[model samples]
Target: MASVGITPLSAIDWGAPWLEPWRVLGEPLAQRVTATAEPVHAVLQSAVGARLPVGFAPQSELPAGTAYEQHIWDTGRVPTRDNLHDFFNGLVWSQFPQTKRRLNQLQAQALATQGVRAARGPLRDALTVFDENGALLSAPAPLWHALRARDWQRLFVTLRPLWAQAHLILFGHALLEKLVYPRKPMVAHVLQAQNAINKIATWEGWLCAAMEADAWADKPFAPLPVLGVPGWWPANADPGFYADAQVFRPLRATQADARR
Candidate 1:
């Protein structure tokens, strides 16, 4: 039996808030591994039942009623590079398996009920896009305020310094299945630090578009289409679309320059 030899959370500097959830989940397992003779992977595997999907198996389809996190692990599809990202995702599964499961259930339900319509409605579109390559952004209050106000400058530049405080949680197990190729620093949703802000800002636009039809004024954290960002998807990535300097402002000085 192989074990990852779970390390102490204090000793590991994740450098990102998104990684915190994984650290918390893995901490106890690491302690158990240290205290007992069982392997680390074995210990984690023990917690997962046989009904889940494999993270490594690309052909692995979600069985009806299968738990989402379990399916991800069963498929061995976690886009972990044996690095911080990898470990963080593992920890996320350990801690929020139920939430993860719920998300998957929503996606599955949408697919079964809606099929692949050209326009899969607003909420359904959001759910499909997010489950495939969606990211959860736990941004600061100011950032959300800026987004809600449509103050692109404040959200993209003025308060960019606080971007470090933002946390990104990826929920794209199907997207991770394609990681067998050379993994780019930037994936479908986001691959870089700048992409985080850009993607979130763009997702805001989708929310706005959806609101035109749906009464989603209550669900702020609902999933969004990552590719909805201007200059992201091919059809919407035209220079003219990103030319709205107000929305996609150019980065000239440092984010901290405004404060100075």
Candidate 2:
């Protein structure tokens, strides 16, 4: 029962492997949408209960001249819009409250010290990039080296068997939205997880504690064409799938030179 401008829950391919982790929370909320944020808020509240860090408010509730992150920090109310983007955002907040709160805290601190300028400082910029399109990759060392080097063939084929020891979790709301209609070129700014993790809650706790402004300012992310991850997309099973140079680009000569 989606309202105008909202994608129906039934329309989304919940069976998609990428969406499987979030289907539990997303499916029920999608069925409850009806032109307002209240239903979304209610579901979030019931799911997170007192543990919910912020309350969901209509987008119009946000005051003019207020920053989005600051508003969330000051009032603990997230101005939610009735769209797929915000829908996924709310789902992330519910799923990763600790990590979400840490990100907001960093954003608020930056706004307080730096004020809103034409350009967001490096830390804020990095935070936003990760917030909008970040992912976590827990894989073996060799796979990590190959990915960081942008060695697509080695990562996807040569060391393909190592994928059994890997798990990739999408953390960004926008990333989730884009995956609803997956495209081969869709990429994620990936941060490596230090240890093997089996549970989402464990990842959340680790990510929250790992948030560091100085470290993030350097933009330490590896670009990963998500679908290229083994078994995620059937088309990628073909040996020639990585042949698309445009998507599975090798490391730039300049970067390679620097590495040497």
The candidate that achieves the highest TM-score relative to the unseen native structure: 2
lDDT of 2 at 229: 88
Error of 1 at 181 (Å): 13
lDDT of each: 0.44, 0.86
Per-model TM against the reference = 0.39, 0.93
Can you tell me which runs of candidate 1 are displaced by over 4 Å?
1-17, 24-44, 47-91, 115-122, 132-141, 149-152, 160-260
Score residue 225 of candidate 2 by CA lDDT.
Answer: 97
- Given candidate 1, what's the lDDT at residue 223? 24
Write down the worst ten-residue block by lDDT for model 1.
177-186
Q: Per-prediction RMSD in angstroms?
A: 12.6, 2.0
Predicted structure 2, TM vs. truth: 0.93
Candidate 2 residue pairs in clash (backbone atoms < 3 Å)? none
